[model samples]
Target: MKQTDEVDDLLTRAGARWRADQEAPPEPDLEYMLSGGRKHRRWVPALAAASVAVIAAGVIAVLPDPKTPTAPTAQAPSTTAATPDARTPQTIAQGNDDFLVKPGDKVQVSGKIIAVPGKTPVFCPPLAVPDIGYPPGKEPAPSCPDNFAVKLNGLDLGQIPGLSTIKGVLSGEATVTGTWRGGAIDVDVQTALKPLDHPAQTELECPVPPGGWKSQPSNISSTAVTKFLAAHAYQATGPIFRYPNGTSRGAPVVILIGLAHGDADAFRQAFEKVYRGNYCVVPTLLSQSDEQRVTNAIGDVMSGNPKLGIYSASGPGLYGGRALAQVTAYTPEVKAALTPAGLDLIRVIPQVRPVR
Candidate 1:
């Protein structure tokens, strides 16, 4: 057999051999739940692991009652990743505006190389593959006994260097660029994922005063603040930090916090007695608890898909009080699968979108 064909045979055999046991997803951290859920920047360990999404205790109260609902409102799908129509290989490669890549196209992707005991390593799109695990209707692929990830949408980085050295799962993360060969990514270049020594500086919403904001010792303990915020889940958001306009990425961070709704003077009155640093109280649109409630609701909605392997990640966005979810691929069928999820509180985005 040709050397390339020999390698292909090796991958086919390896993929058909291994089976993986599923780890039970983790439970929610009660404290994190109270701490005002974070933006996309911070990872909630347990929630990230289990992909916990909330569902309503009964029918969603936010949803309009089916019997007397007025005319359905039209919402344009949010992200460019969600296409106007179902994508095909030809459309993706031929139409520059259609999608990113297609069969036989060159592509570069970064992620971990996952290798189980008898299976050859396949490049797992660590970031692209949703932390939410398999979408609602799909089976766990690692447990399946078949040639896996050998498809156009997948990156099968066949037989990379160092596979002989590792014993368990994962080859860490790396940048891989290759030509799509209909079934696998024909490797062209590979390199380690470099760490960012210096990330772009971020600024505070409130401009720094002349002398700059300094952290002053607070008589109000952190635990006390957490307890206070926890009780006032309706209006309080946990403390937020940002660097002064030109400060380096690392800390001596400036801290700003807001508590549940109260008059501006009253907010100053409460904090002035305890806090020495700057803080602001803003109006609340939706609480973290409310976002979490709808988040879980959407989780139930997203899992309705039976077509399998549509990955997703979901959580609250940084600024807007809306919960957001990004699906790996979404079609009219998949959209149909996710029903009455029509809540305004949440937005569903598909990375591999179908165009209209």
Candidate 2:
């Protein structure tokens, strides 16, 4: 009839079969029952019959038949693989792997834009193929190392005021997307350039003084001499100082002369006329020169064996001067020669004033 009545009927039939299959416990003897065992023996047979009925009902309710339905099981969520972002920046060295991409492959890279000596903008250009000369009036092709050059198209490197010279070692940050031809990288659409706060220092270890002065006169001019002294006069805040000559106190003065383009004779005459007396002059070389002469002069001074040396100064005008001493870059070659001669090569950087 109803589903509940049908279940009860099935359980009743199963329980009856289970009970028939089980062997009943033997009845206790009449004598044993009489000896106080009757109470414990009476409940044993009843409890056993009840347990069989309960087990049969549970089995019938839980067991599944061929046509019966079941609940679906839960499953875990799916996962995805991660990939590298193309927009992320990489170092110039890391991006220039030959095996990673083929020649003429387009890729993004970033690095410092360095300026090397030469009239052209490309720094560290590829070396010319020697023995095979170029055609007359035909310019050789410009080349660069894998990680070196960046195209100037759509990039404004000159906008940064800190970049003062195109001839010296200048450096700034840049990011560009370009095609890498065998020797040079040809930049295309996307690019960016940012100048650093301070321009890179020269390879030579020397101070670049500041404060602008009038150009030295072609001939020793009294007016030019006065102006030059006034421009470089000892300021309480300035590094250059007017010290008394060690040999003669107060009589002879030591002036740190920063010659622009005046000769030794012209500088001496101008100083004598301006101060109205003879003085010792110590000049600093601002440009590169013969490494051997510079090293010898510096070595003599450090060893307390000062020598007669000439310093060539160039600016708006050319000035050459014979000085008691001078300082310049002390390179590895200089150090090697001086060390064995028992000369201590002290690193001395000249003090310079800021350009006004």
Question: Against the unseen true structure, what C-alpha lDDT does each candidate score?
Answer: 0.36, 0.28
Candidate 1: where are CA atoms >4 Å away?
Answer: 1-124, 127-150, 153-204, 209-211, 245-253, 258-276, 282-286, 301-314, 317-321, 333-344, 347-349, 353-356
lDDT of 2 at 41: 14
Error of 2 at 53 (Å): 81
Give lDDT tens digits, candidate 1, residues 1-356: 21112222222222211210111213122233223443232222212311432221111112111111111112221111111234342332233223233555665545445656565555543232224545554534332112223322233434344442232443545556677543356666667653212212221144566776643323233555546645544443434433344222221233344322334455556555545344544332234444455455555554544232234434332232234444333334444544344334333433332222
State which candidate has the highest TM-score: 1
Candidate 2: lDDT over CA atoms?
A: 0.28
Residue-level lDDT of model 2, residues 1-356, one tens digit each, is 21123233343333332322223323122222223332211111211322322322111111111111111111211121111122221221121122133345664444345555452333231111233445764534434433324333333456433453433455554554556543334555334542112212211111222442211111112455546554433210001212132212122222234322224455556566554322334332221111123234444444442111111111100111111111122223333433332221112111110111
- For each candidate in turn, the TM-score is 0.42, 0.18
What's the C-alpha lDDT at position 160 in model 1? 44
- Model 1 Cα RMSD, Å? 16.6
Q: What is the lDDT of residue 8 in candidate 2?
A: 39
CA lDDT of 209 in candidate 2? 29
